[model samples]
Target: MENKFRRIMRTEIHKGKRVHLFHDRLVTPTGKEVEWELIMHPGASAVIPIDEDGKIVMVRQYRNASDDYVLEIPAGVFDKPDEDPLVCAKRELEEEIGYTSEDVTFLYKFYSSIGICDEVIHIFVAKNLVLSEQNLDDDEFVTIERYTLDELVDMIFDGRLSDNKTISAIMTYKVSLERA
Candidate 1:
């Protein structure tokens, strides 16, 4: 069987540093014309920086999309096409939580909103952290928060931790620890 959907043409409606909006014209299996609205992003990275004592570093910031301040692991988009995900992860951790790690490990990567957006989030675990000055972006309004691994697990179960990338990283770490 042939692929039903075929992109006949596309036009970029808008573009930004992190995302782009596009209008795509396509044809269905039956040769019906259709148009789709799509959002594209350079993707991002999130870090669940864990100190030597097993405390996970997080940040509380107001997300306009959520209309409230939410606690989440430090994360940022990869602005440069050639930027390493680990570097972005490290930068985010230091910028948002004021901590640098001697060892950063890639945990997992996943898409954020797969239906309409091509945003992939790379997650990392940073260990052996060194306290440092925060170099947050001018637009970033964030406060640092730390929670023990056990406390974070409880937060996940109680739904207090709602950010997608944060949840994924914590859950991955939890499972990996259990297996280890």
Candidate 2:
């Protein structure tokens, strides 16, 4: 067996701080050629910070792409391509929610939008958290909130928590706890 898909060519369309857009031509297994627009991301890490009382730390902020305020777990893009994802998760948890976790366990990683983008998100469950000072980015305006695990699960099912990463991380953590 051999590879069925081949990238014919790629052209960078735009380059930004966090993402780069590209136009590419590919040849399929049937020998048909097509063009696709792809977004290249540096990847990111998200953390579900569960406190001793079982409350999860979350952040609410305006998302320009969606034109709405979204509730989500603390997350941040990898500072460098070689940066450790767990380190990124820890930094984001502290920076966004003012909590530092002594126990951070990796849950899973997945692509945010496989159809058009190459953005993988590493999810982690942070336990034994201690309060710290939030250090949000200059342009970031986030409000930290804590919710019971049950409330978060309800929000996920009721459509109140719609951010993909947040939902995935929350559900994954809950399932992991059940298994343990």
Alpha-carbon RMSD, candidate 1:
1.6
- The TM-score that candidate 2 achieves is 0.96
Q: Which pairs clash inside model 1? A: none
Q: For each candidate, what TM-score against the reference?
A: 0.92, 0.96
lDDT tens string, model 2, 1-180? 455889999999999999999999999888889999999999999998888888888899999989999999999999987789999999999999888987999899999999999999999989999989999999789998999988999999999998999988888888988999
**Candidate 2: deviation at residue 159, Å?**
1.1
Q: Whole-model Cα lDDT per candidate? A: 0.87, 0.92
Tell me, by TM-score, which candidate is best: 2
State the displacement of the C-alpha of residue 34, model 1, in Å, after optimal TM-score superposition.
2.8
How high is the lDDT of residue 148 in model 2? 94
lDDT of 2 at 43: 93
Tens digit of per-residue lDDT, candidate 1, span 71-142: 899999997866899989989888888988869998888889888988888988888999898998988999
